[model samples]
Target: MSPIKNPTTFFAYIRRAPFGGRLTQGQIDGVNAILDAWEYFKLTDHRWLANILAQVFHETGGRILPVRETFASTDKAAIANLEKAWKAGKLSSVKTPYWREGWFGRGQIQITHKANYLKLGQRLGVDLVKNPAKTLDPVIGARIAIVGMAEGLFTGKKLGDFFSHNTDDPVGARAIVNGSNKAKLIATYHKAFLDAIEAARGAVDAADALPEAAIADDVKPAESSTVMSLLGGTVGTAGMSALLGVNNPWGFGIAALVLLLGAGAGYMFLSGRWSVNRIKGHA
Candidate 1:
C-alpha cells in the first residue's frame, strides 16, 4: 500500500551501474507503474517479470523514448494518430521503424524480428507490423510485453538473445547495460520478478478475503437465509429429496451445517478482529 521506501532496494538487483547514476523521477514512476500493472494482471513471477524489465532497461537505457531524439513535427501527427487509434481500437495494422530497429527490440520488450512481433502481437490483439509504435507508449508497450511473457516469448531465450545485435561483442550486451557488473543486471531482473510475485500474492490474498467481507458488510444474515431458502425449496424437491435420502442424509445435513459455520467464520473474519492484531503486530 505504501511506496517502496528504499530507493537502493529498487535498483538492488541491477547487474551494472544503471546507464545513469539514478533513473529520472519520471522513469522511476513509469517503472513502478509498470510493475504494479504486472502484479495486477497476476503475471509477477520473479523469473518472468524481472527478465522482461531487465530486457527493457537494457534496451531503453531506462527511458521510455526509444532514443534521445524527439519526434519530428511531421512524425508528431502520425504519433498522435497512432495514439488515437490505440485508444479507439482502430488502426490494428501499423508498424513503425522504431518498432523494427530502434532501442531494445521493437514492440513490447522491443521485440525486433517481424516474425516474433507477429507471433507476440496475436496474443495482445495487435498487428505487430501495423502498429509498432504502440510498443513505444509506456502503458501499451508494457501491457503487450506482459502478455508476451505470459505466452512464453521469453522462455528458453538466453539473455544474449535480447542484446546480441546491440553490442559489438554479443556478450557485451550484459556488460554494456550492466556497466562493469553483469551480476547486477541479472539481479535487477531477479528483483523485478520478485517484486511482481510479492505484489500479485498480496493482491490475490486481498481478493480472496474480499468476498467474505463484502457479504458481511453489504448483505444481512436474513438476506442470505432468504436466498438459501429459495434455492433449497426449489432444488430440494422430490427427486432431490430422494437423492439426498439415498445418498447420505447425514452427509447433506453435515454439509449444510458446515456451510453455516463457514459463513459465520467468514463474518467474524471480516469483522476486523484479526485486523486489529495485524495492525498491532506491524506496529
Candidate 2:
C-alpha cells in the first residue's frame, strides 16, 4: 500500500514538487483517478507512483494534472514534416487524411491512432471508438497512463524494467514512454517528486502512529477523513480545456511539447518558483 493514500497529501506533495503549481480542480480529479487506477492495477511500489507522477507532471505541463492533447506547430510545412517524421518512425501508416482528421494522441500518454485507441478501448472495456474523445477523460486517461506504462504497452519498456527495490533508474525509465528523448530532464523531476512523496508518506505514517488525544481537535492531519472529504468536495471537478490541435497529424512533435513539462518542472525547482518551503505555506 502507498503511504500517500490520502488524496490531499498525495496532491499536496505534487504541488510542492517542481513545476506542480496549484493544480486545477480537474487536475485534482485526475490525480484521484490515478489513485483509483493504482489500486485497480495492483501497483505495489511507492517508487513506481513517484516516477509515474513525475512523468505525468511533465506530460501535463507541470500542472500535476491531465490535459487535452497539444499541437507543435500550425504551419503547413511543419505539419507536412511532422507527417513525414511519423512515417519514417513507422509509428503510423494511415497517410495524411486519417492522420490529419482522425482522433490521435488523445490521452496523457498521447496514445496515438485509431487502431491503438480501439485496442486500448477493448482492453479497458471502454467504448473509445464511439467516443474517442473519452480517452481524454481524467479517469480513463489515468488508467491508460498507469496500465500502459506498467505493462510496457507503449515502447516495450515497463516500469519494472527501470524501478525496483534494488535498482532505480528514473532517467532510463523514460523508455517506458518515449525512448529517452528527455530522459535526464524527467529523471530530475522524478527525484524532486520522490522526495516530496516520501515526506508526505512519512507525515501520514507519523500521524497514524500518534494517539488520538495527542492531536488537537482543530488540527486535522492530511490523511484524516475530514481532510480527505474537504479536499474532494471543496474543489469541484471541471471539464478539461479543449485540445490544442495542429494542422497536421497529431503525433510526436506537438506531443513532445507537452512532454517537455518534465524539463520545465526541473527549471521551476531550480529557480525556486516551486519549493518545499512554498508548499508548506499552501499546506
Candidate 3:
C-alpha cells in the first residue's frame, strides 16, 4: 500500500492551484504513477514526496503526465514547432539548438539535451539515446522525475538539502530540480501537498513484519518488503547516482548566457531543462 493514507483528501487539496481546480483522467493517472514509483522505491518521506508532487504540478503545467516542449501534442508537432521557433530566432538562447536535433524536452522532468539523455539513460537503464520517446513512458517518466531530483541528477542539488528533519524550504527545494524560477509559487504547492500527504496513512516498514531468516541479505532495511514483492524481490542500484550536474533550461545561469546572446532561451534549459526547463515561459 502507498504511504499516502488519504488520496481522496490529497486530490481535493491539489485542485486549488496546480490542478486549477480540476483534473483530467490523464492527470490522475500521472499522479498515481508518481505515487506508485514512490512506493516502488520504498520512500517514506512525506515532505520529499510533497516536493516532488509540487514540481510535477508546475513542470507539466498541471497536465500531470510527461509532456513535450511547448506543450505539443505529439513528437512530430513538437519537433516541427521547435524548428520553427529556432529558425525565427524565438529560441535565441539555445546555445546548441538541441531541439533541432530531436532532443526537445520530454517527460515529467522535461529532460532536454542529448548529453542529459545519454547520461540519464545510462543511469536509468533505458535507451533514451536511441529511442528518446521512451522517456514518455509512464513508468520511465515517473522514474526520471523522481530519481532525477532525489539523486540530484539535474542540478546537483538533492531533496535532503532543503527538506530534512531540521529544515523545510520549498523555495530552495526548487534547486533540487531547477533553480528558483517559481520557487515561492512551488512552495505553496509544497505546503498543500504536504497537508495531503500527512492526511494519508503512513506506511509501516514491511521489512519489520518478516521473519528475520526469511529476509534476504541484499535487501536493505529502508525498503518495505511489499516493494520487494512487487518487484519480484529485487532493486537495482543503477539509478542511484550521487553525481550532481547542471542540465536545466530554466535556470538563471543559462538565462544569463541567453541574455548575453540576445534574449536567449537557454533559460529554456535551466528553468525547464530541469521542466523541459528547456525554454520556459517562451516558445
Candidate 4:
C-alpha cells in the first residue's frame, strides 16, 4: 500500500480496459475517496486494497460509490422496491424484509441487517445505527468497506483468510462481504483492480521486496578497439578452420560463434549498443 505519487497515471492505465475509457467526476471521487482512506489508515496490502475496490465496484454496480440495496434514489424508494421484490417472490433467500426495519444494504460494503449497522457503527466510532444514511458519505463508506473487510467484521471472514503472501483466493474472498455468492465475478473485478493498481505505481514502493538493476536506456556502442578484437577473432577463427582441416565453412563458423558468444550473447559487434551488466551476463 505504498502511496501512489500520481493518481492520474492510475486512471490512465485502467481507463480503457477496466473503466471503459469513460470517467465521471463522481467515479473519480469515489475511487479517490477509497484511495485516501487506504493511505489514511496506513494499510500496506495491495491485495486488500484491490479486493476492497472490487467489492466497491460490485456493490455499487460500477458507480464506485455507496448506494441503497436496490440502487433506488431515496430510502423510501429503496424500501418500496425491496417490498415490491419481496411480494413478487424475487427474494427467495431473504427470511424477512430487512429494509422495512431501516437496515437495508448501504455503503460500498453494503452492510444490511440492523446488527451490522450497530456493530460497524461502533467500530467506526459513529452512530450509524441512529443515522444509517450517513454511511452513504463516500468517506465513511470507503472506511467501512476497507476496515470491515480488513478486520473481518462483515461475515467473520477476513481479507487475510483469502489473500496472503503465498495465496490469493479472490473467489474465496467473497466470504468477507457475503457468502460465496458471485465469488468468481468478484474475483474477476479483483484481478482487474489489482492489475490497475500495480500498473499505477509511479515510484518504487518502500515495502516492495524485489531486487532491481538500473539499466541506462541508451546503451553505449562498442569502441573501435573492441570492434577490431571481434573482427580479428572471426578472421582468426576462419583461418584456423582451414588450417585445422575443417572442410565445411558453415559448420566451423557456427561452432565458432556458439563458443565465442554462446552463453548469453558470446560476443557483440561494435555496430550494436551494449551495457556492462549485459556483457557481464553474457560472460
Local distance difference test values of all predictions, in order: 0.45, 0.62, 0.70, 0.72
Which 10-residue window in model 1 sums to the lowest lDDT? 208-217
Residue-wise C-alpha lDDT for candidate 2, range 1-283, written one tens digit per residue: 5556444345455554564443345555555667778888877887788788778877877644445445442334434655667768754644553446545466667776677788788889999888877876777888888888888887788999998777889989999987878889998888876765676664443332212211112332323332335323322232011112322212322332343454577778999999875345553
User: Candidate 2 at residue 87, lDDT?
Assistant: 69
Error of 1 at 281 (Å): 41
Give TM-scores for every candidate, taking all chains together and pairing residue i with residue i: 0.39, 0.62, 0.68, 0.70
Local accuracy of candidate 4 as per-residue lDDT tens digits, 43-131? 98888888898888888988898988889999999999999999999999999788998899999879999999999899989999999
After superposition, which runs of candidate 2 have C-alpha atoms over 4 Å from their true positions? 5-9, 71-98, 203-283
Clashes of 1: 17
Q: Model 4 — TM-score against the truth?
A: 0.70
**Model 3 worst lDDT window (10 residues):** 238-247
Ranking by lDDT: 4, 3, 2, 1
- How far in Å is the alpha carbon of 70 misplaced in model 3? 0.8
On TM-score, the leading prediction is: 4
RMSD of 2: 16.8
lDDT per residue (tens digit) for residues 1-283 in model 1: 2232332334332212343333344454456656765765674234445555655665554663332222323345544544565567664554544422432244335555566667666766776567655666666677665665454464433443432345223322243233344545555554553563444343222222211211111233223332234235433453233333322323443444455555566667898654445344553
Best prediction by lDDT: 4
TM-score of 3: 0.68
After aligning candidate 1 to the native by TM-score, how far in Å is the CA of 280 from where it should be?
36
